[model samples]
Target: MEAHSASYLRWIVVLLLVSSCIEATSFSKVKHKNAYATMMYVGTPRDYEFYIAVRVLIKSLSALNVEADLVVIASIDVPHRWTQALEQEDGAKVVRVENLDNPYKHQNNFDRRFKLSLNKLYAWSLVDYDRVVMLDADNLFLQKTDELFQCGQFCAVFINPCVFHTGLFVLQPSMEVFKEMVHELENGKENPDGADQGFISGYFPDLLDKPMFHPAPNGTKLNGSYRLPLGYQMDASYYYLKLRWSIPCGPNSVITFPGAPWLKPWYWWSWPVLPLGLHWHEQRRQTLGYFAEMAVMLIQSAIYLGIIAMTRLVRPSLSKLCYRQSDKSINLVHNSLKLVALWCIVAAYVIPFFIIPYTVHPLLGWSLYLLGAFALCSIVINTFLLPMLPVLVLWLGIVGTLMVMAFPWYPDGVVRALAVFGYAFCYAPILWASMVKITAGLQLSLEREAFLPRLGEPWPPSSFKLY
Candidate 1:
């Protein structure tokens, strides 16, 4: 009797194990179907700021009558409070993946969480829609974005680094593709930058069939317009630099950035006085300024270093430190070094030519011309052209000292120190400002509020239903 009872228990355990496997398999496998479009947005509920942005985004979509599903893949503990908030709009389908090890919880990194959520969502391909349009929670749809559904194969609007912005893209979610993407992401075979864009760019090389370059209808008029259509993805950094390119706009406009117009001061000048919602342009402008300033400072440092080198060569005896060489050889070396340095500086700053001129005002053409000339002269003289000019000035200052020493005195230390200081001081403010703009712009409160009642509507419908 004891042996029989033990055998029965073992059989029961085996049965239970088999049942578990079937349940797991059911979750993993998905049914396939013909083309159908659905919007997908993913985020962790723990991040309150991101949650706010997500709500606003959903509200914007609802206003445009676009049907979207928001997938909040988080830990079991993440509050269901957002569901109540989202349901108020009746414009979004909120799916909370429960009792799972949410990679996004606690960790500020988006890579791991994004991968995990994407994997799970792809697994639902059988029950979910055929095509999935992935959007970031922080994205605000300004116009009707239905055109995105018309995309064939995989479709995404174009942005730079020549990679598709993962902020918004269309894909036929499949188990095979999901598995492939997760494997690639884990192995670093995809997304060297470890961002969504990098992952998509590396994984689905032939995904985006159509390329909508601009982010807004009048994006060309906006400063630094490299965004992917107004209804697609609008990053604030593009606006900060004032590059003014093309952007698509309509009902599908998407405005995305860190700080809203109310929070950012830089964009106050350009944003509409009675702004409809949060404006993301401020953040883009801040980012552009930061990068441009860094580039400028790097070029300036090269020029200053070249200047110091030339000065030391000219007055070796007067200089605190000296290179052992004949006067003629030193002069030749100085001139060559200066020229090379100057050329390098110019090349670094000028190669990536902007379509729009960077002058403060086109009417001040002569002033702009003079400024350019001055800058050019500074570069040429300091880097390559006139090595003796600085030495001549130094010589004039130390005539008495030089006469006493009976040698050419070179103030190498002073020159080098000045060069370093000049470079740092000149570029520091620009870099700081740029950083501020980018950081501020990327902050979460920039999107419009998702829940503002029309007129006399109740806070949440008294007879609302949940599925």
Candidate 2:
């Protein structure tokens, strides 16, 4: 019995090793047949936003060592210089289609918003491959997803209950289907969501109701249905959902940004408005890290509350706390600009950190984010915030910058300005506290004129402090 058992175990081990080799070979063949594609529509000029995103996708693909052909479809407005760079530098087959004239409306905000949905159909023009995966430019793949190519030509994630997010999908390129879709659009077919997603779902209306089965690259049949393992096409905003527990596990292949246009990862200014950016650091961390980013956000929130407290609660208490009140009329516009500069200063610093993850090709995004941040900051600061300290900081910065400029080896004045503005921006907490106190005093002077009762005064702040 022992001899037979030993022989059986040996046979099982041999079969497992043979199966592994067979699967590896099958994956290689799938790579040769499958391709990854993205679409770019530029009606006015070059779209550096999409280019930046596409570059990251290519870099990530290289990092993951994915074995699929990368393809890009662009509109005529996009310059060949950029396309050639994409092809030569990033190894992409960029096909420029004539600027398509698409006129379709869904009678909603999203559908009536953008005029470029029809450009995505160009993916079907590439019939050279047996299968293709369409990934949005705003997506980042965290792990190898060569397995997705194994799914059927119509595999996608069931994003919400019955709806599928079209940000990521697998489909076989067919010119015939593309033509039919164009015909339908020309014939006034309506898409409720108003984008390629809505239009494509119109083609597979019953996709949400049914589960599909197809062959994997390993020559084994598997379920190709709308799969939602939370491991693929994870919406970045989904991390912000207030749930008890959402620790990352298993294989999270793609991180999708299905957020508003302003919330795109490239738009760093939006981070200050929505704390959703906190989850970004959390997602990239191991061991859960105890929500360290959220702690920072909480501090940010507390600072915001402290401002409100000074403006609302503390101002009223000054009367009861033996504070002398005198009339001091102030310019409303000046104070308003002070508020603007106060907020803009935060955005200026916060924006730079957002682009740190994309070290490559970060120059454009960083400079743009900083310029925009500073332009807005300057407008607000020069307008208000009383550049008293900032101007001094700036002068010292100018001295330092001039020294750097004296050295022929240093970068341009613009780079030096970031360093100056960076130090100048650091005076937020002091400025914010002083601004709130000053503004609150002015507010109280105005409140007496309105004949409104004083808001109940909370205890003095110093009394509450534990020494």
Q: Which candidate is the best by TM-score?
A: 2
Model 2 accuracy (lDDT, Cα): 0.54
* Count of clashing residue pairs in every prediction: 45, 1
Top candidate, metric lDDT: 2
Over 4 Å off, model 2: 1-31, 44-46, 105-113, 212-228, 242-250, 270-433, 436-467
Cα misplacement distance, residue 219 of candidate 2 (Å) = 4.1
Per-residue C-alpha lDDT of model 2 across residues 437-456, encoded as one tens digit per residue: 64554344334422222345
Candidate 2's clash total is 1
Error of 1 at 239 (Å): 3.7
